[model samples]
Target chain A: MDVQVYRVPMQRLIQGNGMPQESDHGVAIVGMGIVCSIGDNIVEFKESLKKGVSGITRLADRKGPKLSVDIGAEIKAFSFLDRLYRYSDIPETLLQKARHCAQRSPFAIQASVLSALEAWQDSGMVARENDPERLGVIVAGESTTQNYRYGLHAGFETDPEYLSPRYALQFLDTHQVGVLSEILTIKGEGFVVGGASASGNVGIIKAVQLIQAGIVDTCLVAGVVADLSPIELQGFVNVGAMVRGNEFQTPEQASRPFDEQHAGFVFGQASACVILQSCDVATERNATVRSTILGAAMNLDAVSTTAPSASGEARAMNEALRRGGVCASGVDYLNAHGSSSPLGDATEVEAIKQVFGDHVSKLRVNSTKGLTGHCLYSAGVVELIASVLQMEGEFIHPNKNLENPIDHKLRFSGARFEKARIALAMSNSFGFGGINSSIVFQNAC
Target chain B: MEKENIFSVVKEAIADVLPDVDTEAVSIEQNLKSLGANSIDRTEIVMSSMEKLGIKLPLVSFGGVENIEEMVDILVDA
Candidate 1:
């Protein structure tokens, strides 16, 4: 199948004057909310970080030798199904465990709705009945398999003689955005970003562009995934990406992002949403500003499907910094897309070193994946939330599982910073198909 | 099967399909839909009833059935 590629010219956002007009297309992040294995909300998540609580645990069924490893940072306690039923009268059993899959999922919508509500409340934006069309939603995930069961049921009902309705509903292509739009009553632009891990960053960047283009007044941007499916696990196992044997004894130890003993990335689920509005619009409304998305850039490797080239990541990072009108020296902290995979981590580190060069040594770099696990599409938003917390709390969470650095050239924070005063921070996300996305955020007073 | 045995099987099927549902409220005269049986729930009830009773009835056989009486009648005829 041929994939259609879309690109926004680098010069479009940077024409005429050196700086883009403040009002021309200024976007500000007013509020942020996230739910992950670490915590349900930002406060609880921060508390977990402060206490160094690891959410990873071994899967109960894999206690025997049938499976090689059982450790994972699973969100077993989330009442997502309850939330779904609260919105609609769907039976819990009909929805089943299949509803939690990130693809075509109602769980993603539930998470996004919760986070979006929090963001809107934080932004003090009233949900005016007339302004419904002005609200937009952009969600990111790779596939849409969550509605499989629903489709099958519908099909069986329609063709009871020839086919089972249950089988038909189970086969529909249900994207995360479709479920969210229906549940949230968002009638405006609704899009589901599809990429590898970069889907989240891509969603945020697209949301910013949409708001700036006057397409929507306010945008709910989120990345969500339900990572508990057996097929998802088997896919990673088939690719030799999951850690096995004694390494999976402890969930926290299974994911060692920048450590020399790092094996591979662990799959996990998470969701985060931010309320974004124009800076001038937010100021006029006297809304609280959480963080400013200074600049963002995405690029395609055009090389390989799974492996990201070091040069591609470096170029994307440099482009984002340049677009933000900041130098490498200005970045106080760097959130590396360190998946703990041997090649992926090495490529990200090399990219950082290449872009920052001499200043790389001075950068406070950390990978939150070691704590939360690689949350696929939701990883970018989770990392962004961590960056915001780092700035707000004046502390940088340590990479929990790191014992030894993968390379001497890359610098990793030895201990959590109690007084991190980050001025500008950059978060990097690289996904399969060589898709790379980088965004720069600045602390707003 | 005796009428008592058949009724017990039907109660068990209803209990399995509606775990949280009150089994005592489900009588032969009570409408399944009125007893909180949506289309999906009703299908599950029928499936569970078939599995428990060891009786296979065509789905259309229960189309007009509103209560357990009609369902039981259709199952007996099929």
Candidate 2:
């Protein structure tokens, strides 16, 4: 069979760049809301990125004390109850729902509330006024894995009579999505997407596809880093995929993506939401299109579940660029899936270099995990926010703690620098099961 | 457990499930539905209460429980 490629032609190019857009393929990012270790809001996050302040902390939560790898990116002042009340006018019903699943589900709920609300507020979409069926919600996470790990284990040991029926509802990722849906009163379709660390990318990419397919006029793509329990953290420790010890002076400096001294990824927790609308729906509402999701694609390495595959990753990126009608040379920046794992970082650079050929040096690639740790499902979404910030500011953030470059073949942002306007950018996210995903984004000119 | 003590435990369970609730205002004979718990939430609350009270009330006994009083009776009698 012949290798086939397709394109969604440029509608009317935004004023800034000549990149394609304004066509059926243009899914505009109208709003973004985030709550991460770096900062609770975009203002703080951008400042932290500018200063290169690391959000990785010494594990101090319920799971923090149990792990040998104690360092991670936990929201420092994060208390689910406090955060929920502080950020949102959460109703009594939602609060009741939250209290019901208070055991292992509040982390995603609380973070989603903060992020989704911010996105909604920024979006100016009155769900009550708009067709509720046209507004949808999708969350990406691994929280159900944590729930099964802890809840089921505890349920087995406890007396059935005393078993909280709440545990019965704990296994569904939709519960988290349900909370967001209820809060927004969005009656459209909703579900969860998980592609390991790429889950956020998968979730948002899925949302973009839905809107482009006319499945809905608007969608909220959310990825909340779901590490509410200790078992998931211990899973990483058991697999020897976590950075450990007092080798690094500060816990914040522990994550060093693409650095020669990179040991492994430190887990991080947070949440982010991107409000996407079909270009017409967005502009009709006079929404501010922060950036347009030009194209997205995902694939699996079926070759090796645990081992990273450069060929599979290259294929996914190549497909995404081809779908967006973006040439390898046209990509101005790349937000890498550089999780800092010994093999992961090397393999990703190999993929980028292999896919882009001589255009590798033009792609100013960087990773946010250097400061925030690996945000699990939210990694790609949070990094996409970083990419938008780069385009808006015309500055690419430094890959924090990168004292030495791993390969230096790509234009890795070793230090924060004011750069030319980023007309088109891409973000890569590959997960544990060889799930490689990429999305092409264009700045709204 | 004394009747008063059982009521206290039931109220404690209510507080655990709905931390924002004013337990004093919550009546013992009030329907469990008032606790804002669906069957699952009520089960979780009762199960957690059992964990605290060191009792093992059968889930079958929890069926048709109307209010905090019935739930407390099921656990205290067990």
Candidate 3:
């Protein structure tokens, strides 16, 4: 039997004026939060970036078989209750709810909740009465529960009957959506999206679309931490995607982005959140617009391999600039997806050159991964926050270990920070499986 | 296992699941629902109690149980 595959016309009817309407007040970032190896909040993160603090270190004791790679930027001395109390201004009831929901949850979930709460407070959403039904949430990351499930293996293997019933709900990635929506009282659309390392940028782009489509007035996008288990660590090492820290004298010097000594990415863990809303809604509520998201775009190489394509990346950047109604020359700074992987860094540099042309000589490029390590899933959000902080402070952070320039034509921040005026910026994030994404931001403050 | 001992184990399980609850004041006559142990928490407490007592029983064995005393009776019998 012959199976007929239906085909549709490539060109459809032209719609109305294909332009941003008046009601489209643009997506503006109103609040941001982060928990990473370098800092616990945005303020500390900014200071760390200014001083060039590296969070990479020898691996802590993980309850599993010893792996070949033993270095990463792990969050240290984390206590859920203690971290919750840091937000002193949060209402007692909300704090209590956070505790009740995440006290017994996994480290990944707990970290996400902390970041989300901080963003919520920073956005002043609690004080300003928001229609619960008009808010949305997006969780960005896949396989975030590997470490949590790895911890439960021994007990389950010996006595399967004793497994906690909550495992059913906690293992899925969308569990973040449930916890965040409940805590923030967000009743609108809620779901999880994953694009490996590009997950954070994908989440931000989705939130922008939701607000622009009038489906939701506001959205909270949480980038989940990649809590890799021993198996994952060994897998990365075997695949030659992660550095083993043997060549470096110290762990801090291992992550050298855009340098001749660059090898592979060093693992890092972080959870970050950003509150995105329409500019009109922010204006109506008198909210402080931290940064305006002028444009966001995501593309793929249509391949499943981890290798990156410069053309795909350049396409994403060009589309983002086009949607933003800005030319390549208009971008002043670029928050590079410099994961410290030699291939990844080289590919991104090539893409930047393709998109910016001669303007590449003027664009100040630096990778936050040099200080924070490659935060895997949360790298996009972490770099986004870093870009915004640099924009707000009018300073470009130092590239921790770019001793020998990989590309001399481009302007790369050296071992020390530099003063720069960055009114417009483009942040890039490319994930495994050919996912490429870029977001353009204009300093609103 | 005696019912009294089983009750003590059940109290500890409740305390582990619901830290805010005062296990000392908990009477066997009071049910887990009244103590703020949601359905999932109640199942966890039951499984934990059974594990501590080195016993295994079908989850449905406690389906008809109404109070801590009744659940303790099942564990004691096992």
Candidate 4:
């Protein structure tokens, strides 16, 4: 399906006139949900942003030799499933299937369900009349696929009889997406997106397309990861991608992005989801449109499989801004994909300079990763929410631990409240598979 | 072992599987299905209860049982 994005002129979108545009093609975000080490929902996450609380800490539960750094952004408390009203009958069937299933259940499924449920409630779509047939769900991420090794171990030691009926279903990449549709009873297109770390934005971008094309009234988009596993840890160790927390006084101080004392990203698990609907559908239902996705673009770096391509990143940025009909200077805030890895952060800064040019000095940029750690697939979604919150709450969070600057030329919001006159915001996400995605959102007029 | 002791163990195991279930009103004679448990939940209850008791579940007999009493009977025999 063609992804129709950012084609509407900026003025038409901004001057919404409080009336549903006749044949509204633009898509708006009606609700959002998130669960990570930082906070459970947007309210709590906003508080964390205000306090500049870093969620990274020592890994608590494990089953192997201690990791060299042994640090992670661990979610300690939540009552996600308990709070959600039973929205579908599939949960009963899924529970029945999984009870005896030998598959090592990954954490992303639960995380996605919680995040999606919150978004569903936040939108209040259930209270109003809506076409269930027009509701769709799309979830993406695969960082934890390696953690489903229990069945492999059992099969290798003995025979395949040890594997249960739900063994394969439990770990399939698209299985978590099905869980969301089942839980929500969304009968529309449901699938998974695999854009590596940029998975969340990629999925959201696609949902906007489906909505703009009038294919679905609402799309449940999510990016989730349950990536804390021995094998996953060892892989990061082998690649030297794990954050070196030795020099830091504390684990929370490890992920200081765009700082002179930059290291690597802390491995964190989280789920972020949003409900996207056509502006007309949202208005017709009288739902609170959090923000509108003015435009989005996804491209491959194609330079290196692992290393970032500044040219590709810049192109994506230009495309999204152009499609959104917003000028580079118009973007008041930038949610940069500052993973804090030496190469990724530096490359992203260069890409920002290349795309923004003279506007680079005018931009107030910050990386939420400094607070929440790198939440893998959900980083883009989480960061996008942070950007939206800045517009809604009248504050952009500080780049915590940014005492020393990487390039003073780039105006990093040094933990100061810039009374958000933010009319437009841009979020960038780059994944390991050379995926570059940029999304532009406009404050609801 | 007393059936009352077996009831305590069974209650604990079921509680582990279903945190929201009221174990106080539950009796060993009640059907697992009546407790809102499915086949898999029943298996989990059995496995957890056996693990707590430090005994291996006879999967065949466990599969054939329809109620909590059958589970206790298996444990008492073991």
DockQ winner: 3
TM-score of 3: 0.95
DockQ for each of the predicted structures, in order?
Answer: 0.13, 0.65, 0.81, 0.12
Better of 1 and 4 by lDDT: 4
lDDT value for candidate 2?
0.78
The lowest-lDDT stretch of 10 consecutive residues in candidate 2 chain A is: A1-10
Residue-by-residue lDDT tens digits, candidate 2, A22-48 = 234768998788899898888788888
lDDT of 3 at A442: 86
Residues A1-445, candidate 4, lDDT per residue (tens digit)? 1122334444433334664333434578888888888787778888888778889988776666666767888777544444333434224544433322212245556667767767877888756656778998888666456665642674446543323334466768777766667656688888888787898899988888777655688999887765656777767757777785877889988888898888888887778888998887788877888898878899986655588888989999998887776678778889999888888888999999998888778788999999988888888888888888888887878898888878878989886555656778899999886899999988886
Looking at candidate 3, what is the lDDT of residue B43?
97
What candidate 1 gets wrong by more than 4 Å, as runs, is A1-24, A62-65, A81-130, A144-175, B1-77
Off by over 4 Å in 4: A1-24, A78-107, A145-169, A173-175, B1-13, B19-31, B46-78
Scored against the native two-chain complex, candidate 3 gets a DockQ of 0.81
Instruction: Give the TM-score between model 2's chain B and the true chain B.
Output: 0.86
By DockQ rank, best first, the candidates go: 3, 2, 1, 4
C-alpha displacement of A77 in model 1, angstroms?
Answer: 2.5
Q: Which residue pairs come into collision in candidate 2? A: A10-A20, A10-A21, A11-A21, A11-A22, A16-A445, A162-B47, A164-B44, A165-B43, A165-B44
Clashes of each: 22, 9, 0, 1
Query: Model 3 has how many clashing residue pairs?
Result: 0
Could you give me the TM-score of model 1 versus the true structure? Answer: 0.76
Q: Which candidate is the best by TM-score?
A: 3
Quote the lDDT for A125 in model 4.
72
The sequence of per-residue lDDT tens digits that candidate 1 reaches over residues A345-442 is 88888888889899877788888888888888878888888888887777778787778888776668654544567868899999888899898888
Q: Which ten residues in a row have the lowest lDDT in candidate 1 chain A?
A: A1-10
**Cα deviation of A60, candidate 3, in Å:** 0.3
TM-score of 2: 0.87
lDDT of 3 by residue, A12-110 (tens): 223487743333335889999999999999999999999999999999998977788989998889999999998999999999889888888999999
